[model samples]
Target chain A: MERVPILKIGDILLVSIQVDMSDQTAVQLQEDLAERIVATGCHGVIIDITALDIVDSFVGRMLSTIASISKVLDAETVVVGMRPAVAITLVELGLSLNGIRTALNVERGMELIAAHTDEREFAFDDEPDTETTASS
Target chain B: MERVPILKIGDILLVSIQVDMSDQTAVQLQEDLAERIVATGCHGVIIDITALDIVDSFVGRMLSTIASISKVLDAETVVVGMRPAVAITLVELGLSLNGIRTALNVERGMELIAAHTDEREFAFDDEPDTETTASS
Candidate 1:
C-alpha cells in the first residue's frame, strides 16, 4: 500500500496527497497523522490536495475523519489547494466536509493556524501584546 | 447604547450590525447573542457586517470573541457581507479573525450553516442519506 509522506515544517505538519488514496491508505494516513501530532506536539496540520484531480464521497469522508481526529488531539487541520472541480463535485455529492477548515494555499493555511494559536494564547492571558497596545 | 438585534430565522440566528459599535455596545451585543443562542437553541449564527463601512482591530476581536462564544455553546458562526476594503484593513491591522468562518453573502452563509448541520447529523448516524445513496 502506498503511504502519504508527512513533512514537519516548524510546528506544523504538512501532508501533500499526490497519489490516489485507497481505503487502506487513508486509514494508514489517519493513524500516522495522529501519532505525528502527538510526537511532534504540532498545533497545525496542513493537507495539500493540489495534486488530487478528483474526489468522491469516500475521499470527502476521509478528510473529515482526519480533521475530527486532529481536533480531538488538540491540533487544527486545514485542507488547502483543493481544485475547483473537486470542490464542485463535493458540493454536488452533498458532502460538505463540515467542521473542517480550508484555505486557498499552504501559506494561508499556515497563517490561519498561526492566528488560531495566537488567539488561544490571548485567551489564557488577559494582557494585550505590548506592541499592539503601544500602537493603539 | 446601540444594541444589535438578533433575528431568529428557522433554526438560525441573524445579526446585522448597521450602527457604529462602541466598546460597550460590542460587549452588549456579545452578551445578547449568547443569551439568544441559549434561549432559542439555534445551531447557527449569521453576522452580517455589510452596513459597516470600516472596521478596526477592536471590531475584529469582537467578531472573534463572538465566534468563540458561539462555538462553546455548540453553535456555528458565519460572518457574511464583509467588504473588500474592510478585509484589506483587517489584514493590515494583523487581525486575521482566524477562527471565524466567513461567506460572501447571507445566502451563502446560510448554505454553509445548513451544510454543517447536515454533517453533524450524518456523523451521529452511520447511515448515509437515502437519496444520496440511492443516486450513487
Candidate 2:
C-alpha cells in the first residue's frame, strides 16, 4: 500500500497527490488523512493534484471522501491544481464532486483557506443560526 | 438570434440557459448580462446550465466571461445544474471553466448567491483584502 504524506504548514495541512492513485492507495490516504487531521488539529487542508493526468471514478471519490473526512474533523478541504482534462473526465465519470471546494493552484487555495478560517470561527461563535456558507 | 431572458429575483439576476448556444448567442449573453447587472444594481447572478448538454470552448469561455463580467461590477456569479456528461465532455474538449462557482442545482445555487451577497457587503466594509472567494 502506498502512503500519501500529509505535511503541516503552519496550522494548515498540505497534501499534493503526485502519483497515479490506486484504490488501495486512495483508501490508505483516506485513513491516514483522518488520523493526521485528528493529531494535527489543522484549520484547513489543501490537496494539490497538478501531477495527475488521469482521474478515474475511484480517484475522484477518494478526493471527495478526503474532503468529507477532513470536514468531520473540523477542517476545510480545498483541492487545487486540477488539470482541465482531469476535471472533464471526472465529471464524465458521474462524479460532479459536489460540496467540495477547489482552487486553480496551491497559492490560490492557501488564500482561500486563510480567508475563511477566521470567518468560520467568527460565524461559529457569533451567529450559529445565521451562519453564512460559501458553498455552491 | 435568440435572446436569453434575464429575470430579476429581487436584487439577484437569474439566467437559465435553456437553448443550445451558438457563438452569437453566447457573445450576446456576455453583453446583455453585463448591462443587466449594471442596470439592476444586483449583487449576485445565478446561471442555470442544466439545459446545456454540450459545452464547447465558445460556450465554456462564455461562462467564464460572464463570471468575469459579474465580478467587475462587484457581483458574484454561481453556475448551476451542470449535467454529469456535459462536465466530462467540456474537460475532454480542453475547457475547464475555471474561476467560476458551480452548484448542484438551481435552489442550492440561489442560496449560494444570497449567502455571499450579504457576506460580501460586510467583508468589503470590514476587510477589503480578505474577500472569501469560492472558485474552482
Candidate 3:
C-alpha cells in the first residue's frame, strides 16, 4: 500500500500522482489528503497527474471530492498536468469533474494558488498602507 | 460574416458552436450572448461544443467571458459537450477556463442548470416541503 506523497510548499500542498490508482487507493488518498490539509493548514492543494494515462469514474469522482472537501477545509485545490488522452477518456466517460479548478502543470497551479492567496491577503487590508505614526 | 445561432428552450438559452471558430466569431459570440442574456431574461445558458475538436485560446476566452457576463446578467451558464481533445489542448495551453461551469453533454448541462434554478427558487421558500409538496 503505497501512499501518495504530499509536499508542502509555503502554504500549498503539492500532490503528484505518479502511479496508477486502484479504487481503494483513490479512496485512501482522498481521506489522507483531507487529514493532511487539516494537519498542515495549507491554503492550497495542487494535484499533478502528468504520469496518469487514464481516469476512470472512480478516480474522477475522487478528484472532484478532494477538491470540494479541500474547499470546506479552507483550501483551494488545483488538478494539474492532465494529459490529453486522459482528459479525452474522462470526457467520453461523461465525467466533467465539475467545480474543480485545473492548470496546465504544477508551475501554473502554484501561480494560480499564489494569486488566490494574494487576493485573500488584500481582502483584510481595506485600510491602505498609509503609515503615519499616531497623528502624522 | 457567420454568426453562431442561439436557441431558446424554456428559460434556458442554448448555443451550440458547430463550426470552427475564428477569433472574430469567438468575440462576436460573447457580445451576442451577453445581449441575448439581457434580452431573454433567461435563468440559465447551455453552450454545446461537442462538434468541436479543438479549443484555442480565443475560444477558451470566449467561454469564460460568456460565463462571467451571464453571471452578471443574473443567468447561470454551463458549457457542455467539450470534446476530449479540446479539453486536453485547453489544459496544455494553460487555459483552464476558470470560473466557468461545465457538464459532459447537453442532457447533463440541462440538469446542472435546473439544479441551480431549483436551488434559487427554494431559497425564498422559508419552510421545507416535508410532504413532498403536491405528491399527487
Q: Hey, what RMSD does candidate 3 come out at?
A: 19.2
TM-score of decoy 3: 0.45
Report, for every candidate in turn, its global Cα lDDT versus the true structure: 0.81, 0.76, 0.75
- Backbone clashes under 3 angstroms, per model: 0, 0, 0
List the candidate 3 regions with Cα displacement exceeding 4 Å: A1-136, B126-136
- Colliding pairs, model 2: none
Model 2, runs deviating above 4 Å:
A132-136, B1-136
| Candidate 3 residue-wise lDDT, B2-84, digit = tens | 56656555577767665567778778888988888888799889887755677887778878888888888888888887778
Candidate 3 lDDT, A52-129, residue by residue in tens:
677788778888889989988988899987889988888788889876888886668878888877666665464444
Leading candidate by TM-score: 2
| Candidate 2: residue A41 lDDT (0-100) | 87
> Tens-digit lDDT track for model 2 on A1-136?
4455565556777666655687788888888878878997887898877657777777777888888888878788998878899888887877787557999866678788888886776777887754555322
For this target, which candidate reaches the highest lDDT against the unseen true structure?
1
After best superposition, candidate 3 residue B51: deviation in angstroms?
1.3
In model 1, which regions exceed 4 Å deviation?
A127-136, B1-136
TM-score of 1: 0.46
Provide the DockQ value for model 1: 0.01
Clashing pairs in 1: none
